[model samples]
Structure formats: structure tokens, C-alpha cells
Target: MSAVVRGLVARGAGQELTVEDVRLPRPDAGEVRVRIRAAGVCHSDLSMVNGTLAPPFPLVLGHEAAGVVVEVGDGVERVRVEDHVVLNWAPACRQCWFCRHDEPWLCASSGTPAVARGATADGAQLHVTLGLGALAQEVVVPQHAVIAVPPALPWAEAALLGCAVLTGVGAVNNTAAVKAGDSVAVIGLGGVGLAALTAARAAGAGPVIAVDVSPAKRELALAAGATDYLVSDDRLAKTIRELTEGRGVDHAFECVGRSATIRTAWRSARRGGQVIVVGMGAKDDEVGLSALDIFHSARTLRSSVYGSSDPDREVPELARAVLDGSLSLAPLITDRIPLDAAPAAFERMARGEGARSVVLFDE
Candidate 1:
């Protein structure tokens, strides 16, 4: 038997999303059914529609989400019915070479942009974002797609832990290996960027500068523990260098997934510093770099996929921090909205108007 639930669906690229009935199949062996409680509107979700990514039509949109396991398959053991969990969009295949080598984030079998599953109300085949169309009220995913978290964790905050918190913090701790007193500049003040700021501050990084195209993000940047905020402009690199006393920052994080922003991040770092690309960009959107500049700067450029994090080991630890109040996700969530408001949330994200607009579901 299948379960019917409401989900946000986009029939084609650039089309307005519609709330429609989605019929989900029952969890088979090694699978589980999750009732989504909260889902964060992430930029990656926006990419699915804004031409940055090309996913199948009639796609269910969402990935950053938290929910409860309401049904478990015969072989399920990691979670039980009613267990709170965070959706792991990039679930690792433990037997893959990456997983065997401790690089599960680069799991060979995961991270598909869209997976064919379920059906629309009219019985047309459906595709889901990142294999977990969490914008829906319920989803049937492989057991590995859900990570158990503290039950006491709020649904909204927990949803963010799946993507924003994990990616941002993981980029800092795991990918960049940022140490105390390291000067940092983060470009883009979206949910992930702000989360990066919070993690940087927690790691004792100083002069943590936040940059974004929107001037309105100043307040958000400061609240997220940034020592300074700058509106992204032609002078961004020079300004960052000035703030760093002509040395530029030790690390520059490009949270906006654009070639121009990537170059800006590259320029915002000091010679021999690291420029970490935290945002996902379109493949054709190439960043032009001069060979002479690369040699002269001697800076390293790398991209952090899923924060280069293994969600299974990190989500539980992050949940504990949220439970103990050692890690605060308050700044990450700018609004708590109902599911119906999800389309508007995407608009806000497109405009770079807020940090994160979390869609909350009623229990």
C-alpha cells in the first residue's frame, strides 16, 4: 500500500511550485518512511529550478529537512517508529571506495540530483530532489538517508542541521581545518554562510568578515558573530585586504556559487592562503584564473562538497551540541513559516533577503 501526502512540486524548470498530492511507496527492506516536520529552503533547492541545475520534470523539491521515522522496513535498525531524524541527502554507500577510505562525503553511489520514485496525484512518475524530496509531508528513503538525532531538538533547527549547519561547520572544521586566531572572510550571507560565521567564531577565528550582495544582511552577519560586514562590490577584494592590514584573510569562503564570486573569494585571501568554495555552481560557469597570478599567489583553491562531512558521525554530535546549548542555530533561521509559504521562501532566498526561511509542519 502507498501513502498519499501533500508535497511541493515543480512540473518544469522556472515553473511555479505547486502543492500537490504525492503517493509514496511503502518502505521495503533497508528503507524507511519519514514524516517530514520541518524543511529548510536551501539555495541548492533553488538551483533545481533556476537553470543552475537540470533535474527531471514533475520533480519534488527539497533536501535540507528533519522529520520523524513513522515506518520502518523489516531490516531497519538504525531508527524506529517515532524517532526524530535529519535527512541526509548524500547518504554514503559504506562499501564504496570513498567510504572505505574515510571519505564518505564523496560516496561513489550518492548525491544524485534527482531520483525517480513515487507518483504524482495523476499517477505520473515522479522525481525527487537529492533522492529525498523532503518538501513533501512524507518520504520513503533508504535507511541510510536518515540520521537519528536527539528527540528534544526542535524540528526547525534540526532541519537546518541536515544541510546548512553541517555544510558550513564541516567546511570550517573538516575541510579548511581552521584554527584559532585565523582571519576569515566569508562571501555570501545565506544560511550556509551565516552558519560558517558561527562556526568560525566558535573555533576562535578573529575578524570573521561577512560579505554579501545585499546590504540588509549586515545585521544578520553581526548576529552570526562576524567581526565586520561588507557589501559585495568591485572594491571587495581591496576592502578585505585593507581590513586584514594589507595581508588579506587567511581563509576566504565563497558561499555564493558563481564564477565571479569565486574570483572574489580568491582575491580576498592573502598570498598562500586558502580559498574554499563552499557553494555549488553550474558546471559551465567557469572561473577564469591567470597562470601568473596562481603562481605568484601560491594559494590553494578547493571545493568542499557536503562540507566534506560524513553525516552519520556528525549529525548526532551536532544534535548533542544543540541539545546542550553549546552550539546555537538561532541566527541561521530567519523565519519560521508553514509549508504553503515555501514558494515565497524560495523568492526570498533568490533575493538574498534572509539567512534561512524554515518551513515548519504541524504535528
Candidate 2:
């Protein structure tokens, strides 16, 4: 049996999120009901509040969550009852061209068939944030969106691998694939930026420069593996070149979603280097780059969605890294609040004052 639990929901723009009791129905075929243990409060939630990620009304606003599987619907063999798991927002359908071609992250972009999963408590059907909305105490998601984890990994630490960690680390390791001894510059020291720093360090990158406006975040970046830190400003481009002996770093990752930061990430890369745009800036915003630069610089820029990840393969490996102390996730948490405090937590994120606030639930 599953219990109705509290969760944060954005009714609309400029409106306070109301904490409500929502029900979780029994899992249908190819579905599982998860009892969410920890949900990360991400900036995307603030975007939803301010009408940035405008999808639907009264949306459950979080994508980074991990929990336990208490019940599995029919034909669910990958996970069993009581199995610990990480909820992935992007699930790939095996038959899709992207999935069959070794790029599951680009899975056809179709809606999950609702016949496989039951409706919400209020009988008002809703779409999951990227497909797995794990913010609630219970989530009825397709089996493909769930990644089972080792019991030793705490739910809170594992939650981030679902999105933030994957986007950050995967941007460097998978998308950029920066080589050992390469120089890196990462703009925006949020959760993903910090993860990028750690991944860059692990990849043997030298002089990994971290750029951000927040000094607290600069400190966080240093702890995560940044060799140097800088404040974001009009001189950011010039400073990045100055740091890399007037050549700039080999790779630059923009994890913060903004046009200016996006351009900064581009300029931070050395000529012929790679610039990976991991940030999700406004669709309307455009960057002004001299057409000659494309030919003159020979740099490569690519969009990183879900960190180009295959969750079934990446989540468990990340969890193992966490267990070995090579991946420091437990310390990244700045606030741990109950499900009721989600609104306040998101507000804190909007103010750029929190590291990673997680919403916990009694399981």
C-alpha cells in the first residue's frame, strides 16, 4: 500500500507553491511506485516558479530525486520491492533510433504512454518533469526511468546523480571527453559546475578554473577541485585568456543558463578547443559571435542534454564512486528540509544563497 504524501507544486507564475496531500495509485504494467526519500531543490524549480520552464500548471517542480521501490507493477524484473533506486528524468525507449544507435539521451522525445502508468491522486493526469517527477513522497513512473543502487549509498547523495551530477560530470567526461592534462574552465559554480570541476580533476585536467559571481560558490568550487576561481564580469573573457597564458583553456563548460554566461563559456575555450554548452538558457536569447571566429578559432560547441547519459549504466557507477570517497556528494548538501519546506528552499535558491537543499520524507 502507498500513502499520500506532501509535495511542492507550482500553480502558476508569481504564485506561492502550495504544499498539498497527493495520492499515489498502484503501479500498472511496466511501472513502479517509488517512495521518495530525498528530492534535491534545484534552480530549475525557481525557473518553474518564475515561469521559465513553463510546461503545465500546478506542476511538481523537481527532477533530481532518489528513493526506494516499495511496489513493482507486472513485468517489472529489473527492480524488486525494497530496492534502493535513483529516478532518472530522461528514460530511453530501446526501439528509438537514438537509443539503438548508442545515444539514448536523444530518445525520440515522445510522451510516455499513460496506459502503462496510472493517473495522479486527483485524477488529473500530469506530465512528469522530463518523465520522472520524484519530488512527491510517491511517484508512479515507468520502469525505464528507475536506476537501482547499492544499499550503502544514501538516498540524498544518490538523488543528484539523477540530474545535476550527471549533467555536470557527464558534460566533461561524456560530452566533452576532455583528455588528461587538458586545461578546463567551467563557468557557473552551481551543483553541475562543481561536478564538472570534480570530473575535470579526475580526468587529470590542469589548472581547472572555476568562474562564478558568488564567493561561497567559489569556495565550493575549490573544494570540488578547482585550481583557481574568478568572478563573472565583463572582463571574464579577457581574464580566461589571461589565465591560460593568453591562449585560454582547452575546454569550457557553461552550466548556468544565461546568454552572457553562455558567451563567456565560448570565449573561455582556446582556439580549436571544445566549448560544451551544458546550460539551459532562454530559447530566445542569442549569442553574437563573429562568423570569422568559427573559421578562425575552429572550436566546437555542442548542447548537452541529460549529460548525454545512459542512466542504467551511469548511475550505479557514480554511486560506487561515491562509496569510495572519490566523489564527495554528502558535503554538497547545504539544507535538508522536510517536504513541507520546499517552497522556502526554492526561494533560497532564487536568491542564490543555498548550495543544494534536499527535501526529505518519512519512508
lDDT of 1 by residue, 1-363 (tens): 999999999999899988999898999998999999999999999999999999998999999999999999999998999999999999998998899999999999999999999999998999999999999899999999999988899999899999999999999999999999999999998999999999999999998999988888899899899999999889999999999999999999999999999999999999999999999999899999999999999999999999999899999999999999889999888999988999999988888798899988988
Best candidate, lDDT-wise? 1
Q: Residue 51 CA error for candidate 2 (Å)?
A: 2.2
Model 2: residues with Cα > 4 Å off, grouped in runs:
1-3, 110-127
Structural similarity to truth (TM-score) of each candidate: 0.99, 0.94
Steric clash pairs (candidate 2): none
* Models, CA RMSD each: 0.7, 2.3
Candidates' lDDT values, in order? 0.94, 0.80
Give the least accurate 10-residue stretch of model 2, judged by summed lDDT. Answer: 110-119
Candidate 1 — which residues are off by over 4 angstroms? Answer: none
Q: Model 1 — which ten-residue stretch has the worst lDDT?
A: 346-355
